[model samples]
Target: MNSVVTRRNLLKLGLIAGTSLIAPRLFAQAHTNTQEIFITNLHTGETDRVLFYDQGYYLADGLDRLAWLLRDHRRNEVGGMDPKLYHLLFSLQQRYGQQKPIQIISGYRSQATNQWLQKNSDGVAKVSQHTFGQAVDFRIPKVDTQELFDVCCSYRQGGVGRYLSSRFVHIDTAGVRHWG
Candidate 1:
């Protein structure tokens, strides 16, 4: 009996060897690069330092805790917030290269709260994305509000509201729009 080696066999072996050598590095990098979001809800006086994404997977429990933290304080309503909002905040934190907790002025407003705001405040929209769990009004401590708004605008991922007088920026997963 005789044994034979073919070019295809060598190629397959090379690929297998290469993957074996590279797979661990890829896995390590993915796990090491965890995505975190630090948030402080001003209304509720609650804070969270969440590791929401790691190893190419999102932690649902972390996200749920985030939603609870961002719940409507007045009505005690918790909306199922869009996960992208957390990712957006994470990206914003990365852009700033600062881990300071984002001060949340508003998040997950209930319909009644939104309607009340709309009726009372000229700035509030009758049909605000806040009522849909897709919006957040936030500020980063020690970061210029305008700079934060500019960075969020650069992403062009959604609407950006610069509330200079209020000293916060509002971001939403809605059609791109800007307002004071």
Candidate 2:
């Protein structure tokens, strides 16, 4: 009887075990659904859907182009925004499905855009998290913007700003308690 241990056998064993370990992760990735957020434009009365996946967030199908129109600064921007905020937005959609789409007046603002906004509007915060891609300005389409502000205040995730004339509520991941 002759028996020889070879590299081929070891390779085959490693391949089988590695595939077994990664199979579940591949399955989960295939099964996961995009996070859904609905934005309602207060002035236009238009509702739109936005989807967020694991990648650097891209505009989802059926999303209002106006809501995500900040100037691109992807190359020079920070990206560690907490996923919890996206989940919170999804929860809001679930809780208020019947209402008009919650309008994303602003999301993921670029530093240049934030600077321009700060220069133009007294309402814009000097140290806004929007510049860091960690805040959003939103409102409910056809619903009173104040109602949206009230809803955001209930969550207590971060900063909440009520801008009545601007017709939007701002939510951030700053972990500070504020409303204006």
lDDT of 2 by residue, 1-180 (tens): 123456767778999999999997887775365666665544335555656653334444323343343212332333444455666677677767735566666666666767788898787767768767677777655667778778788888888888898887778878857666
Distance from true position, residue 106, model 2, in Å? 1.4
Query: Considering summed lDDT, which 10 consecutive residues are worst modelled in model 1?
Result: 1-10
Clashes per candidate, residues 3 or more apart or on different chains = 0, 5
- After the best TM-score superposition of candidate 2, give how far the Cα of residue 7 lies from its true spot, in angstroms: 56
Model 2 regions more than 4 Å off: 1-34, 40-81
**So what's the TM-score on candidate 2?**
0.58
User: Candidate 1 lDDT, tens digit per residue, 1-180?
Assistant: 123457778789999999999998887775556788988999888888988887678888888899898899989999989887988999888777656888999999998999888888869988889899999999998889889988899988899999998899999999987777
Model 2 gets an lDDT of 0.64
